[model samples]
Target: MSQRQRYAIIGTGALGGLYGAMLARGGHEVHFLLRSDFDHVTKHGLKIESHLGDFELSSVNTHATVDSMPACDVTIVALKTTQNRLLEELLTSPTRDGGVVLVLQNGLDVEADSAAVVGADRVLGGTCFLCTNKVGPGHIRHIDYGRIVFGNYSGALSPAAVRIAEEMVTAGIDANATDDLLLTRWRKLMWNIPFNGLSVALDATTKQLVDDPHAVALIEKIIQEVHGAAAASGIEIPETMIDKTIDSTRTMIPYDSSMRIDYLNRRPMEIEAIFGNPLRAAKKVGAEMPRVEMLYQQLKFIEAMRCDTC
Candidate 1:
């Protein structure tokens, strides 16, 4: 952006709070759009407990509503995909002329919603390889990995995108830009399809799921199905990605996935964005994910039952 652009974070949850706090701590002007923690954050500010190092921002710029936030050069959407319906208002409020919407979310075929608001050329996608969650109001616990890979939804990596990645690095984050958005999404799904789904389906933590031999085999099957789906869509995810993802998880701290937390907290799960959308993309190209499809339906049923009970 021009002359060190301003930033606005739409969701003040785990990923959003961690990123926005780092940016603000790195001497950037960041306005956080908050719902629940507005009073706490606006008063006590944000507390980030990270694996790298712990830090706190005692005074932060926070707003309760989107309309109250200033128009910024880059607006990061760190919300779960279940809330994409608000993209129309969320994308417009914090973005000024020539500003871009950076989507730090999961799933495929999802950027179209942001594009529909701000035009395709101005929508960027970020794949977050971070293990983080909100432990309490305005407090985030970042246990492992905080690297972000950014790419333009229009398949053109702009100088602004690279600048944003570099700024993230300046904020003590590991980040970079990529030309292949689709490839990055597919690679993420390779890990999400198995760990996130099984975490909820079996009611297990990442360590629990990866520890059992039988469960590991099942995860392998789900990964293979996701790989096949990607291949049919003309995206070639490396075969070694499977082992790499699983191996990385083995070394990760025992944790619950976002889906597991959602299910437990009675919050909505992002089944459509994480599972359904990818399945449909594969279906369009005559690819089927029997294993992943079965898991998807199970999640849908669980989600429906959970909502009904709640």
Candidate 2:
């Protein structure tokens, strides 16, 4: 592996732009697979402002379509679940080859989706713990800690994974490769399933949701339900993990969940991938998820209404 791995970020949104800009600024050869806004990004460059600091990149390689992009060693996918079909197109397109597709998406089904397109050996499970959003075209505004966790789903950490972790660390972002990749993914889901629904349903911030008595109780109920479902499915999640998630939310009180932002902006939400997957797993385990199911239905209805209005 070379000291600097060539990186291609698939979705140049908030988290993707942040990390891509960081790697490019750190002297790595980075390219951004963008959409129709490629000309705008190319003209103005990518900008990122965060609680940790601020940085900008002036010479970012931007591609409007994957068909025009060069083959890279690693491709980081930061798209929402609704965009998975598009990702399928990219992975199956002639432009794709033997590169590792690191999915930094929310929800638990990223591996399954990516594996269907690219082989399991080429798919990596990744989760990003950060509060970030696009404040403008080609600009990402980060609000909290930015750390990336990734690993192989087959329980084997490849040398490529290690090299990617080292490159992320060199860019001043914390990255960890773990043996228990599935467990880490489920843990992150536990946080997203409850908090994301509550944030969207109530239009509340992380602090407000975790601080309110009724909201806190609701979140706890959802967490316990998810934990029960996970246990039934043969995943061991520590009891203390729920409390730790709550504490983390307390510190990130001002931060708004991505679901909330998506709802406010009238964008498609990840209700199915984030909430529906766990609900289905719970059903498979014979565990009841009344509250979680109710929220899921509510979000679906909300999304329907948004579409109807448009």
Q: Which of the numbered candidates is closest to the native, going by highest lDDT?
A: 1
- TM-scores, all models, native as reference: 0.97, 0.94
lDDT of 2 by residue, 1-310 (tens): 4567778888889888898888888788888988855887999898889887888887789988877777777888877878888877775542247678888888766678878878888888888888898988888899888888899856589887888888889888889987777677788888898889988888888787877999988898888888877888788999998888888888773877889888888989989888888788779779888888999999998898884333
lDDT of 1 by residue, 73-123 (tens): 999999888888888988898899899999999888788889999999999
The CA lDDT at 259 in model 1 is: 89
Model 2 reaches what TM-score against the true structure? 0.94
Q: Which 10-residue window of candidate 2 scores lowest in summed lDDT?
A: 89-98
lDDT of 1: 0.90
Model 2 misplacement above 4 A: 93-96, 308-310
Error of 1 at 19 (Å): 0.5
Highest TM-score against the true fold, candidate: 1
